[model samples]
Target chain A: MRSYLSRTTAIIGMGLLWLAALIEIYPIILVVFSAVKSKPELAVNPFGFPKEITFQFFATAYDTMHYFRSVSNTVLIACVSVVLSAAMTSMAAYAIVRRKNRFHSFLYMLFLAGMIIPFQMTMIPLYKMMVDLGLYNSYHGIMMIYLALTAPFSVFLLVGFIKSVPRELEEAALIDGCGIFQTFFRIVLPLLKPALTTLCVLNLFSVWNDFLMPVLFLPDDKKMTITVQISKFQGMYSNDWSLLFAGICMIVLPMVVIYLLAQRFIINGITAGAIKG
Target chain B: MQTNLRQKWKINGIWLLFVLPALLFYLIFLLLPTLSATYYSLTDWDGVTSTFIGLDNFRAMFQDRLILASFRNTLQYTVSITIVQNGLGLLAALLLVRAFRGVNALRTMFFMPHIFSGLVMGYVWGFILEPNIGALNNVLEFLHLDALKMSWLGDPSVARWMIVFVSSWQNLGFSMVIYIAGLQGVPRDLYEYSDVEGASRWRKFASITFPLIAPSFTINMILCLIGNLKLFDQIYSLTGGGPGFATESIASTIYKVGFYNGIEWGYGSALSIVLFLCILLLSVTMVTLLRRREVEM
Candidate 1:
């Protein structure tokens, strides 16, 4: 009886895992396979291996979406914004945490309040601000907006991580003749690598995959990011399943590749991000 | 005493120097926008013109059918995503607790979708659930289950559910990862004690595992609530608030009303302020309620 019970439980576990694996990958598999199949094959063999595979769709999508420019625009925007948020927020969080004053709590509430305020509330004014700044369709304008949007969360996350760091080390660094900026850059920043990485990767994903800001700010196709580019493609190719399949794949594949390569860091980064903060 | 006061001022001055850049960005990008919402929401501001319109915008907002439905849909999306995402996450954490072959690969596959923007993910699902040539129906036909092969995005009810499903699928890995971390932190001794007492697996989890991971529960719940309430990208990419106002959330509606063609600047402002309030109220209440539960235990 005991042997039978153990076997039953083990089988059930495997079944559950299989169901989950399907749930996780079903749509994605359809997407991957759809990209490779001809339009006729997609309708006939949607769940099966592609009857004939071709890279034609990818080539088509690459040109249609202006893939190179969009990727560059996305990378440029994500990189600059993340770097700015990291440098600016980490320094601010460090100052706030180290002060040990009422101002820290006041700043905390301010950030927490900022967190609850949706972008929609201020999006109009922000768009107008971008227009007035002569950056409505430029990369720098979008980059500045992203930096502003993500800063509060980054500051909040780092503040939590910063509190857990003992001040004794920083004091010792100060005693060893390191200035405050030097202590922060050389000592505290090193200790914050894990949290910093978490913040950067998370920020990178948000900025890279962002649609609303890019659609609104970078209205010009030349300035458009990949997400917005494909969205526009979807509109043009709404009826053309074959071309749309390839377009979606072109947009999704790079991120999927990046995630696969950096799976360990990505998972570890977010885990630390959540558990500590 | 005078020297102490001077020293305090000097310390503040030094710290403020370090934080100035961040504060400047926050003042312009975040704080300014938040404060400006009040003025815009109450006025007849349409980019080129501005006039104080009092509560007229708010009054018009309540009578707007699409706005009402959008707010209702937003609430439903939040509640459903929170419960389902957390429930599935806890289950994944439980299953993955015991190390097995391909565990790492499974976790990676699960998390891979989340890295994509929700808009792209929506488009991916849009093709899969596209009625005639869609993968979902294609499979149903092959299985001879043609009755189940409904146009997934056609019906109002089914369209919203598909949005929820796609959102949950994309976000499951995030919730699961957090829960697994929470599970790892639950002390092994408690489980050992339960085992010694011959308690059932479910009972052990109920009595110990669940309570210990209460903090993760709170964090995950708050994150989902805030994120879903502010949802825009998925609805935009998937349904476009369509088949005639079926799956519209306020986030999507705001963009449509404000920027789609002729901008209803003041009306959109009022719509978003309402969204902001809903998020603030719901999140604060949830955190307090969940924290109370944690203390009660």
Candidate 2:
């Protein structure tokens, strides 16, 4: 009787999870199916598999959104911002953690406090500052904003991860006549791989999908990111569900593919930051 | 003594150089803007020129009924999203944490929504929930449950809840992932011991599981609160805070008032300050309250 009951419980648990998973995936499936269907077909078979797949809508959306240019723009911005922020913030985090002093501790706390300051609070002044400095509408300008905005949280996470790393290796590196920069870059940075990966993934998510910043700062059509471009495409082609879904799939599919390919690292990065930070 | 002092100074300088790059970005982009926001909130700065009005924006904010309604809507949206999202997340986490076949695949499917931005999620849901040509209504008709069909994002009453629902759907995975980590941290021995003692599932959860995941609970709650309070893109895409301001969040209100509509920079700054204060106050209170529960457990 005991064994039977436990087996039943396990079956029931698995059943519930399957139900939830289907519900979670159904909308996304519908999106993909609808993207391949014509408008009239979508209206008739809104939630079913398409009778035939078509790439015509995808072609139109690709042309309309300048899909290649926008995707590349987003990739360039996200990559540069993540690399710059990770390198700089990791160094700052190491300094803040290792340099045991009142000032450094105070600096650490200041970064922690920075997390609570929302973008809405800084956006107006930051916009004016960017414009005045002739940094608006440029890739490097937005990259700098992303770098600054991500620093505090990056430092916060890296600081937590760095404290767990043993100091003996660094001490040994120093005694071997390696300068502080060399010891940090060669010894400490390697140990910080997991945390840095986490930071880069999370930062990439925000910078890539960011709509408001590019809308405000990078207003030129020549420099629009995919997310910003998609929103604009929607405005012009509001009634075309097929076209809109194709555009959305363009924005979402790359991230989904990356996540599927590296899910273990991505999942671990997210959970690790949650627990440690 | 002189040599020792010089060495300490030299070490400090090296550390300072390490921090200098990040510090410059943070100072110029974040800290300076924040200081200016506070200053601009007190004045009637219309982007170009400003005069110190000394609390006039705050005074005007109280009288603005739109601000008042948006505040009420913001609070309603935040509270509902927090409870519903975390509740579903914890439940999902509990079930998924069990050793089942294809568990990793199920976990991946559940977390897939989080990879999409709020804007994309909003657009996807918006298409599905449209009144006339929407997939949802069409499905209801096909199933012959026409009574269940309603204007999901068209009606004002349902629009706010739809925003809340969409936000929760996108974010529940995050909370679930965190809770799963928390549940994993609880020692397996405790559950095995309880099983030997013949404790009911509820008894086991209430006594052991709940207490152990309190930290995750706290973090998830605070995150949901902050994220929902500042909801913009989702609402922007879903309803545009429309059907007559029925779903305007504090962040959207700031965007429209400060940036979009006539560029009320001073008032927008003031609104943002309020938002920051709300997040600060609520999260601090939540942390304190939730931390006490963790400690007590």
Candidate 3:
């Protein structure tokens, strides 16, 4: 009797899970379907399978989006910003963890406070400062801003993770005549892989999907990031479903591919970041 | 003593070296800009020049009906997303905690929306919900349901809710994933004991699962509250603050006032500060209140 009741519950549970999954995935599937359908086909059969697939929309979207340039530009900014931000913040987090002084504790609090200051609050002054400093529309300039924006959260996450790391390893490295830098780079950093991976992944998503910063600071077509370009493309082609869908496919596909490739790490990374915070 | 003091100075100096890069970036980009923004909020700066207007910008903010309307909209948007996303997320997590076939694929699908930018999601959903040629309306028409085919994003009454629904739809998976992690963290012994005692499912959950996942509750609620309070991208792409400012978020309004409308930098800065305070107060209150609940549980 018990086994039968439990089995029924399990089946019911699985049914609900699949239903939720279908709801989550259906819109995405429709977008992909519409991307390949011809204009007439899209109008007639919006949700069904396309009778004939076409790559012409993809081709047009590619040129109009400046697919390669904007994508590479986005990748450049995301990668450099993620790498540099992680390096700097991790080092700072390490210092705060190891030193354990009043100043370090105060610094830690300051960084945590930074998390409360919304981007909107800083938008006007930051833009003015960028223009005044001649850093507007430049890759490095934007990268610097991304680093600052990410610093607070990165420091918060890293500090939590780093405290769990045993001090004995670093002490052993120090006693072996290794300097602080060497001990840090060789011993402490390699030990921070899980945390660093989590931070890097989160930073990548923020920098890549970020719309406002690039729109405000890098307005030039030559300097546009993928999100900005997609927004622009979206505005211009709002009426053309076929073209707009193709453009969206371009913007979404790369992230999808990356997510699929790194599903385990990405999931665990996000889970860890959320749980620790 | 002199030698020991010198050694302490050397150690602190090296630590300073390690901290300098992040500090410089924070100071120049974050802290300095924040301080300057506070100053600008007090003045009537038009991006080019400024006059010290004292509390004029802030006083003007209270008189501006547009600001008040957007604030109300933002609060509604945040409250709706918080409840819907977390409610459905907790439900999904309860089902997903049990082992089953193809569960990994299901998890992947649920988290897939996190990959798409909000801009792209808004546009895609915008296409789906277009009243005239949208897939949704077409489906409704096919099913002989003409009454359900009004302008989805055009009606002021429906558009705000649609924005809330779309925002939650994009992130429901995220909240699920977080809750799943939280649920998994609950030890199995409690559930085992409950099962042996023949406790009702709701009894077991309320007594065990709910209390155990208090941290996740706090995390999901505060994160959603903070993120939705600063809603921008989705609002920008979906409604552009709308059929008649029906969905203008404070963040979008700040953009319009600061840059797009006429560069009302001073007033924009004041609005920004207000947003910061709203987020700060709410998040802090939630953290303390929720943490107390966790302790009580």
Best by lDDT: 3
* Model 1 Cα shift for residue A176 (angstroms): 2.6
Q: Please, what are the lDDT tens digits per residue for candidate 3 over residues A1-277?
A: 9999999997897788788888788888888899999999998888888999998999999998999999999999999999999999999999998888899999999898888888999999999999999999999999999989999998988898899999999889899999999999999999999888877877888789999999999988998999999889878877988988898888787788877876776777667768888
lDDT of 1 by residue, A223-272 (tens): 88988888899898888767877887777777788777666667776666
Estimate the TM-score of every prediction. Answer: 0.96, 0.97, 0.97
User: Can you tell me which runs of candidate 3 are displaced by over 4 Å?
Assistant: A1-13
- Give the candidates in order of lDDT, highest first: 3, 2, 1
Can you write out model 2's per-residue Cα lDDT over A35-111, one digit (the tens) per residue? 99977888788888899889899999999999999999999999999999999999999999898889999999888
Writing each residue's lDDT as its tens digit, candidate 1 over B82-161 gives 88888988898888866888787777767667888898888878878888777789888888999999989999989998
TM-score-superior candidate, 1 or 3: 3
Docking class of 2: medium
| Clashes per candidate, residues 3 or more apart or on different chains | 0, 0, 0
DockQ of 2: 0.77
Summarize candidate 2's per-residue lDDT along B1-297 as a digit string, tens digits.
999999989987898999999999999999999999999999898988899999999999999999998999899899999999999999999988877678889889889898788888889899889988888898899999999999897788799999988888888888999999999999999999999999999999999999998888888888889888888999999999888888888899998987778888999999989999999999899989998988998
Question: Mind giving the per-residue lDDT tens digits that candidate 3 earns over B1-297?
Answer: 999999999988999998889988987899888888899999999988899999998898898999999999999999999999999889878877778788778888887887788888888888888887888899999999988888889988699999999899889989988899999999999889999999998999899999999988999999899999999989999988888778899999999999888989999998998998899999999999999998999
**Each candidate's interface RMSD:** 1.5, 1.1, 1.1
Candidate lDDT scores, in order, read 0.85, 0.89, 0.89
